[model samples]
Target: MAPGTFSHPNSSSSSFILVGVPTLEAFPICLGILFCSAYVLALVGNSMVLLVIVLDESLRDPLHCFLAMLAAIDVLMVTSIVPKLLGVFWLNSNQIAHTACSVQMFFVHSTTSEESGVLLAMAFDRFVAICHPLRYRMILNRETIARICLAIVVRALLVMVPLTGMVTNLPYCRSLVVPHSYCEHMAVTSLACADPSPSRLYSVSMSSLIVGTDIAFIAVSYGMILRAVLGKESCRRAFSTCGCHICVLMLYYIPGMVSIYMQQFSRGVSVRAQVLLADLYLIVPPMLNPLIYSMRTRRIRKAMLNVLFPRKAHACHGGQ
Candidate 1:
């Protein structure tokens, strides 16, 4: 590991340089502005959602509790990657220590897996509330919701711990230049001088297992909910209630699935396009989750309005 020569195996002082959207080198200023704006909006939006959930006791149902948890996770997920990405884009500071890279990968993957679990839990909440209306309270009380959240955290840890271990122990003897914005597991592992096949396979399998299980459960829960809503009126109401959750699921999963497919199969896709898609997978959901919930869910929309216009809310309350 000489100073000038970059080629070295088992180098002691290995650091990864994250190359975030190298194709956008010409318009770094514009891209920085755009990404900064999105990051700020994600932070503010998710924070507001969490704030409203905390303040409004009336909105403290199981659904709202789950939404609050989701918002918090979104905040963490974006915070883990976006600030570093902003630094790469804005300040041109892309070098991350191996330890720091491992930390980023852990948080990013763990939060994502936790999000999937939370969505599945939310679907279960909806299913029980809709399909077993008489026993909904018994099924999904505060204690139950807390337990579900605990399980989500535990599951994410169980899956991510080993994956992180595998990636961190790999002998990164080659150039440590990560060809992406942040420290994604694939992006980081791909740089290893040793064979990365086992790490890659394990990563894909774990992701597929966790996310696939969640998706299957969500589908089953929603299918049951649909079957239970017998009448036209009930069907409409059920759809109205679940619309926000559905939209959030789509926003979270679709881009990620596409990115995975492109990574595996679409060799013809340009690196720039893949990098952009990867950013979208991480950036879009957090920015839009709060917006979709606020716009599509009447209760959240009303709660946000009340928070924003407290005096007006009090006036309306007095009139009522």
Candidate 2:
């Protein structure tokens, strides 16, 4: 259904399969369940994070501003992919229209790049807050946030659009079955009967540039933060403040880096596992980022508890 897929010639034959994927077996049932669970977790968690951050008056700092933006992006990223994935896996609808598929590919890849930029921004925010606390506000003002968000959107769109052009532009002359649940660039491009080497190379090169630069810059920013924090009077307090960021960074970066490697070289692994891991790379953080990251503040915790049980807790406090 998506633009770059190879569809089954006929649904009638048992031998006919969707692209390079095997027809689902019992194991695939587990995979589908896991996929749905991850999606649900991401949607619910990120939604709650955004809700708590926005609704609570106490949580309105510039840092929380960037975090709210991050949560919003994560919500967008997962919601975009998971609905279609659920339709395919749970409802036996594996068709993604070429137009729809191209759009999906564009958003998914763009969000990936956007997240990278946001992480860099967050890291820089932390660096400034820790190192130059007095000037953090002046340095990263409202105008700066708007500019950074705009730049991230433009940069990601520019980088990923070219790859989308390569994918949708190719003359796909056969079955249009998408091997992956979502319209993965590699999975989509591979379906082209025409040579896809140029597209693949371009994708790899661009990804390397985007992801590599993101990690390098984050490392440098955080490295400075680490040095500054270590030399501080209260190392424990400094570490405590950054604990959430650290968890988020690891949750995002490690799985993502591993996924990049797996995508490139994990040939012997099962496709189901690969798909599951890929899905995890997207979903796990969206879930953990909100739950794990937001718990750092007592105010946020109280706010979350209030939201969860406002009347009862309020009555209890009054009675006490």
Candidate 3:
């Protein structure tokens, strides 16, 4: 419509309430179905990973410990987005409070940090086991694993808390509309009335220092492990386990790189693409993680069969 002319878009906006999403007229039903599928898949798969690891004592090892941490971090990652997503998609509970948004940001950032750190730690564990098998017992004993995990958690919290706090303290009077499905740092930052230079710089600097460092360490550890593994006759078995983990991590990191690139350089990327990419960051890792884990481990596979098919064996034996 012309500047002085009336338009249906404005007329419709005047009659509507902002309790839910701004609008969902086109393909809303299809989008809702996809969202629910991703959420269910992630929730079920990660839960299975946690249940199997926690229930069986024979599953306790440094490798499983890191995998458990990965599963737990993924649980947090998906939960941070899924509830609000269901609300936005189906329920009319779209008005998130200021504090709620900040808490969500903090957890999102912290859990991402933990994910990267745990990946690095897992790489180190495999490195030590493959490259220094004779010294693996001495280097990654139970106490050392606990200490390393503790340090990862602490470092993740330390890196994330302050950055989130800084962003939360800024004024948000310009707009209440968060463009994405959930409360995200970049989406919220775009709403700031004042120049968000400091916050933006803080976010970038922190990501570089924290995430960059974590990936760098993972790279170095894997390089050494590859060198050692290639020299051994057991290289095939070692790569089978290590390769699956690296593939999962790459599945995650590849999308992560795409997101960071699109966020930084591709202003023309559609909002739907942005949301879809973020979904990959959560749903793919959680769903694929358990599949890869159980496939790679004999103990987990045996336990899975025993737990799920116990009555089959009992029936086969009759009363004998």
> Highest lDDT, which number?
1
- Number of the candidate with higher lDDT, 2 or 3: 2
Best candidate, TM-score? 1
- Extract clashing residue pairs from model 3: none
Q: Assess every candidate by TM-score.
A: 0.94, 0.87, 0.87
Per-model clash counts, in order, read 0, 13, 0
User: What local lDDT does model 1 show for residue 71?
Assistant: 93
Pick out the ten consecutive residues of candidate 3 with the lowest summed lDDT. 12-21
lDDT of 2 by residue, 1-320 (tens): 44444444554221112221234533545756776787778787777778888898877766777787888889888987887776665666667777777888888878878887888788888888888999988998889888988898899988988888888877665656666768888777666778899988887788788878988988898788778778668677767877887788888778776776676668987776666566778878887787787578666677778889999879978999
Better of 1 and 3 by TM-score: 1
lDDT (Cα, tens digit) per residue for candidate 1, span 137-245 = 8889889999999999999899889888888777766778898888987787787766778878887888888888899999999988888886657898899889989
Over the stretch 130-231, how does candidate 3's per-residue lDDT look in tens digits?
888889878999999999999989997887777776776665554466776766677777766667778777776776677678788888988887777786
Superposition TM-score, candidate 1 onto the true structure: 0.94
User: Lowest-scoring 10 consecutive residues by lDDT in candidate 1?
Assistant: 1-10
| lDDT, each prediction | 0.86, 0.75, 0.73
For each of the candidates, the C-alpha root-mean-square deviation to the true structure, in angstroms, is 2.8, 3.7, 6.2
